[model samples]
Target chain A: MKRGIAGSLESNDALITVKESDKLEITIKSVVYDFFHKQIEKTIRDTLSELGIDKISVVCEDKGALDFTVRARLITAVKRMEASK
Target chain B: MRRSLLFIPGNNPAMLRNSDVFESDAVIYDLEDAVSVTEKDAARELVSGFLNCAGALPMEVIVRINGLDTEYFSADLEAVVSDKIDSVMLPKASAAYLAELDFLLTEQEKKKGLKKRINVVPIVELASSVLQIDEIVKCPRVNGVLLGAEDLSGDIEVMRTKKGNEILYPRMKLAYACAAYKIDAIDTPFTDVNDGAGLEEDCRFVANLGFNAKAAIHPNQVPVINSIFVPAQKSIEWALRVQEAARQASLKGLGVFSLDGKMVDKPVILRAENIIKKARKYNLI
Candidate 1:
């Protein structure tokens, strides 16, 4: 299983972890989960779809990360995962 | 020149969002020591993304790229060499290092088709760099020097004092070089963020030595540095008085003029004129 990580658990940042999987799967745990869970998931999905990445499981440990932050972390994680392979 | 340049970690999304809120004269998104090696790529991506979307920042924007010696230097340049940034702060700055950076910056400018070249503010921290400060400052695209006493102290095996006594010689040497070269001399940050009085004392000490500005690590230090570096209203009034007195003396064919029972001459008038000029530039008048 190839796994890659990016970002931090600091305030307004996300600790993004991506692992090899059978299909695209995302799990989000956010400090602002009550309000932004959907938005965060949508961001991850949009980013993965845009990058045309598949067969990866993305776990976004988000700490109130904005749209850009979420996208950046996901992209960085994807790149790191690719580099490891 | 900016009175204060606030250093913000490139990887922090929160800080990046509120960077301009502090009202510092400039903001330096740092891609160097503040970032961990593992996260260098993340920071680079975040910084470039932020600058791309953060359109038209009110104050001057700068990026402190990794030094030329590092493997990330090229990528750092590729990420940050944009029109949004007015300058880039190069760490571990030396004559040789600056020569390499100058060539690279020229190439970057050409690649981007930038009509205006990016300016460089080199960090004068290493022992070897202090000796070659003149050569570094005289290098192409060099605009200013920020004396990083923390690294300089460590480099020279000296105790870094809050009073900044140990780095006095480096301070003076850097100030002299910058003054001669007509560039800004920015003092390093006072690391103790809670000690406002100590921060003021350090600012005054360096300002008296002809340093025009200082770098701040925290938002609180911004106001403190600006208060001392910016001309006070009283000084502006006094400068106007001296200016009027000089005009009167010139009209009367008297080389010397009196301002509040004190004899004022060429140098005195020039100093007052500078104060007024700076005030005007800062819109303080």
Candidate 2:
């Protein structure tokens, strides 16, 4: 799969996108970036590691989404990517 | 006594976060049709995480998991059959499915160590299930029955009318079955959010037909359903009068009583007693 996306730009939600890539990369843009950037990144990384998923570029566009929402979106994005190929 | 059960899309966090404050007696987090097939996993995680993390809210929490036939059913139960949820609303319901659900839910409760036994409310939509409603409602785990008119309409090959005549037989069947089993008889939701009058009329019609509660698709419909489903002031007053008359008749050693010059039998007295009980429960008196 080239690309897969999950969630929406709605409030309390984050749009997560996963792209097939040679190396792992993570980028996050959030409304509360300075306050939660590291925390959000840690959540994403912890979730990916826990799920045993690797070698994908992750992009999260956040609108004040909580930890659960972020994790759900990323998991959904990965499932979508896997469903394609 | 859930007068209004608001259906919140399980995938939507904004609504899930504010479920308690919606003025609904119960909130059902929908994991079935409200979610697309692709996001089923995401919704399961999101709902379980939110329910487990958010702690207990004021109102009852019910999760409408996918039917038992689907692959998502067991996963949904694994994620949500916890203390956070008060009940499970099963779509595509049957006695066999209820039996399976009862076993699975009990297993989940034992596995998760949930002290509370999760209730099961089967959505009576399949035509065969409608015919076998009495058997379904008799299940040990069933606490109520929710009428799914939309799917039943299609299953029976009839278009759902504004009057909802297509589902009348099933509605009465559910009402009777639930009454026989002494459980909640919840009506199907009114599809039109914009037509308040139509919704009100529908609620009143079903309430008169013995539906104790109605499902609300939107927040605007909550107040309307609560108003109609709750013991109305007029009925409460009449029930009070009936109780007073019954007390006097019993004191006089009479087996019968009269209210407003009409004979009040055992059934009428029983109905009045139930109304008074409901009013007291709601603190309406």
**Predicted complex 1: CAPRI docking category:** medium
lDDT of 2 by residue, B1-285 (tens): 679999999999999888888889999999998999978888987898788778669998999999999999989988898778899999999999899899988888898899899999899888999988989989977888999999999899999998988898998888888888889999999999999999999999999888999999999999889888878899999999999999999999987977788999788999999999999988899
Checking candidate 1 for backbone clashes, the offending pairs are none
* Candidate 1 local Cα displacement, residue B55, angstroms: 2.2
User: What are the candidates' individual DockQ scores?
Assistant: 0.69, 0.59
Error of 1 at B7 (Å): 1.1
TM-score of chain B of 1: 0.96
Q: Give lDDT per model, in order.
A: 0.91, 0.90
TM-score of 1: 0.93
lDDT of each residue in B73-123, candidate 1, tens digit only: 999999889898999999999998888988988999999998778999999
Worst 10 residues of 1 chain B by lDDT: B46-55
Q: Which RMSD values do the candidates have, in order?
A: 2.1, 2.4
DockQ of prediction 2? 0.59
